[model samples]
Target: MHATLTAPSARRTRDRATLVCGIAGLASCMIVIMADFTTATIYERLGLFADTISAMAAGRGAMIMDTALLILVGGIVAIAFGLWRQRLPGWRWRAVIIALLAVAGIIAAIALFNEYGDGDVNDSWTFHYRLVYALGIIFTAVPLLAAHDLKPIDRRLWLGSYALGAAWFVAGPLMFTVPTGWDGLLERVAAGIMLLWLIGASIFLIRQPDGR
Candidate 1:
């Protein structure tokens, strides 16, 4: 009887943790979206279509963007641990956790190194561009990696993950093909798709009592 009671108690504890992490994930995305929007609007000369997000991070109000990145890192870390507690079969859980943690590390680095400071202090700019590209691929893969597991939990989310991947491919790789000045627009398109997947995935975990 004690063992039986313990099992349910532990499960409930985990469920609460998963729920909190899911909420963290959602909150992080919302915060970053607001920061991006606010910062983008602040610089009137910086064309939203022509200037990259990195450009927004470079000059004034960069602190806001950097702070958002750090918050995102925290959110990703929570999601990684939360997913690890779920019952994903085979290597699905491991893959998802690795991807989430990797993203968290990358974003943390971006936030710490920052785009301010003169003349590439600590060579942050060099690391920045490469990591940005790496982020596009790895983040896009998150939905693809977890789609199989998500199918059973939520069909709409499962289908949406693949759809998000397809959009990411177009926005990421094909951005270069769509005229030079429009790259930023394409980048934002990819980012929006990513945000959708994050929110969907977070909701999936939040709604599941056992974090299925």
Candidate 2:
């Protein structure tokens, strides 16, 4: 009886942790976007296409974005851990967690390096930074496709993930073809897809019973 009771208690704790991490990840994304818009200067507009959000990590009024990114990284790391605890079978879930952690590492690197301006566009660090961002999103989505097969995950959730993944994948290429001022708009749309998934998944986890 004692052993059974302890198991249920532990499961409950894990469930709570997952819910909290999901909320954290969703909140981090919101805070980052808010900071970027709220702190923008008169000349800068959130709708302008500026490559990565890190483009604003430096210069005047950049501290809010920088700090928000750091918080976002922390939230991502926590979400990865929370997913790992779910122990969904097969290598797919493991791959998902690894991919998220890798992305978190890249985000941290971006925060530390600080993109100044378009001058060093051809620099080695800049190249790697952009490459990693592209790779991270691709890798993250690939694993997510496999997650749909996991029994514990809601079918609707996985379907939503696939839809969002497709949108994000397409949005990146669309950035190059859109009108001059639309780059930022497309970028936010892509990022918002993933953020919506994070928020939905968190709420799902919170509502699920301790087991199953």
Name the top lDDT candidate: 1
Model number with the top TM-score: 1
Runs in model 1 lying further than 4 Å from the true structure:
116-118, 121-125, 177-180, 210-212
lDDT of each structure?
0.78, 0.66
Q: Write the per-residue lDDT of candidate 2 for residues 112-139, one digit (tens) a residue.
A: 6665445654485656548556654654
| Consecutive 10-residue window with the lowest summed lDDT within model 1 | 115-124
Q: What is the per-residue lDDT of model 1 for residues 73-121, given as tens digits with 9 covering 90 to 100? A: 8887877777787768878658878988888898787777775335767
lDDT of 2: 0.66
Cα-based lDDT at residue 108, candidate 2: 75
RMSD of each: 2.5, 3.2
TM-score, candidate number 2: 0.80
Clashes of each: 0, 1
